[model samples]
Target chain A: MTPLPTWQRGMRGWWRRDPAFRRYLLREATSVAIGAYALMLLAGLGCLVAGPAAWQRWEGLILSPVGLLLQAVVFAAAVIHAVSWFRLMPLTIPPLGRPGRRLADGAIHAGAWAASALCSLGLLGWLVYGA
Target chain B: MTDPETILIEVLRWHPDTPEAPWWQSYEVPYRADATLLEALQTIKDDLDGTLTFRWSCRMAICGSCGCMVNGRPELSCHLLLRDLAPGPVRLEPLAHFPVIRDLVIDQQDFLDKLPAVGAYLVPAEETEAAAAAPAAPSRQTPAQMADYYQYAQCINCLLCYSACPQYGLKPDFLGPAALALMARHDADSRDHGQAGRRAARDADTGVWDCTLVGHCTEVCPQGVDPARAINRNKTASARDYVFDLLLPGRRR
Candidate 1:
């Protein structure tokens, strides 16, 4: 006897598979980068709580090849985050009015870079001073 | 005397009866000086091929009837002048996130169903005998309060935000941006005391939790309702309820 053929469907259930799944992927990737950054800081905190020997061990790990490579990856992720965050900043605020209109798109991008630079310098100064 | 411009319009055409599924059809149409994208589609339909199907009403942006992907961006065809979009060719497709009914027309039932689930109406509190007997005072609205929900109220239920929304794309039942804006309008109202409706929207997995703060809804919205901000504000409300609202007396209600 001949077996019946399985029916092929045209469109799958939209909720199961849809266009927004791509955005969820972006969020997951960004979150992984953020998690990595968090763990790096927590590692420093762990070293501090431990004895000097333990702290040296942490420092050695920081200087090690694997640690350096991880740091490089983190930095690259951070750059991606920085660009994405800047691109999205326009959505947070209302249209910048007539004066903002005068400034070109490149200028808007430059302004975000300037703000990030100021923030990084401020944070570095505070960390170094406290250290 | 006018120079002719060639626009390669990429169109997604589908026929349910056809053995072959939906395919992109390219049409090279001469661009008129002040022609909107709608005009080009009309040109293709009127002269080139009668099989070309699309949905449109009011030829203007008011009806919210003619929403489609204009060059991979969600826009009202009547509003998108071809001169501004003059880069060789333009892409046209049905709005993303919803199932295409046929060609540019998408199945808008999901968005419509969510409207009722969010309680898209004013729910007045219980009218006591004394309260009912009392003279009904006219509800006066200030310019600022009107300003708050006016843009939101102006939503024509166009699925443009749905197209822009990644959350609605992933989770069809998420109620999306426009519905959330409607909920926010009622929740913010001084008269409407529909906490239950707010709770319902706040409690779904696909409802509010699925949103990962991707503010694309606000970005591609022709009308600036800012549904992302509405959802964020309600997240604070939901968190507040979770922590200490029950502890306080009649505060949450």
Candidate 2:
């Protein structure tokens, strides 16, 4: 049997370094970050339930450089995750319109933006008005 | 006198066992204005590397056999040319959302299974009724009616939609674009009377509900099947049935 050329052996590297694989990595990384962020939120909730003092301590921890940095990283990952997920929104979700007349891509983005805005506003309301 | 053009193809490949199972493999080949991407791959395989493997037949895109990822999009290799892709490099890989069978090949067994689940083939209304046939009835159609489902009928079972589907990538069991589009084709046809088939096939996980309507499948279809529309329309049908369960009477249990 003829042996594979010296370069063909290297071409076999494609199995590991393909773009789909890289995209999968990016998608999964953001997902894992989001999961970790959720855990942090849950822990904060636990601290709040424990006592006011505990909630203050948790708030102080969140304010520290390391926690803020981690939060910033998760925020960035969340953005990446959003973009990837939205770009793929047309697939799993229902189509926004008729066959030939598809709804604008902006509408999908607008929906996401609206959801984010509502969440932000609610958070602000909780901190300012409710508290 | 003229200088010849060249197109570089970078293919992603992988083996199941290798820890570093996936990587990019490049091929530089002479370009021609009329050459299809599949033709380039064929040339590479024939002259350059026999180890390079992909499936092809009826090279004119009718067979729907030669589809893969072309520049991060699902496309028929036989229909796309390097000249259209342009100056330097065009990426080539197996279809997205499938396990690699080899270089530009994908595992299609799961995709095929959904076709059967949908009852894709025509089930003759009368198995033996030659005498009862409508005697040379005139074919009736207005242009507007044809326009409604025309583009969708042109699908040739190319798995490009499967590649474009993210749902299938994550859940291999998802009854994806082509099968659902094929189902929609039958359902859309005024002639078909396969009500039982649609009910059985349209489920929550593998059926119409599984689709998130990303619309990517429709965009990348070489035949312009508009699978997203078909899927959503069927999903609407399913949703309506779910809401009006009492009025619908029976069929789904």
- Highest DockQ: which candidate? 1
What CAPRI grade goes to candidate 2?
Answer: incorrect
Candidate 2, residue A13: the lDDT equals: 35
For residues B1-253, what per-residue lDDT tens digits would candidate 2 score against the true structure? Answer: 3435677888876654462557888888888888888889899988887777788999998999898877767788889866787665888777766666567767676776677888775544543365258645444545654555677789898888877777676677789888888787777655556755677678557798887665667777888788987887787777777777767767455
Cα displacement (Å) at residue A69, model 2: 21
Local error of candidate 1 at residue A43 (angstroms): 3.7
How well is each residue in B1-253 modelled by candidate 1, as lDDT tens digits?
4445777788987665662577889998888768988998899999887788888878888788888887667888888887777754787888876776677777787787778878767777667785577648555656655554566676778888888776676567787888887887777665676866568567577566666667767777777777776666567666767677567756654
Clashing pairs in 1: none
The two-chain DockQ for each candidate, comma-separated, is 0.11, 0.06
Winning model by TM-score: 1
**TM-scores of all models?**
0.77, 0.62
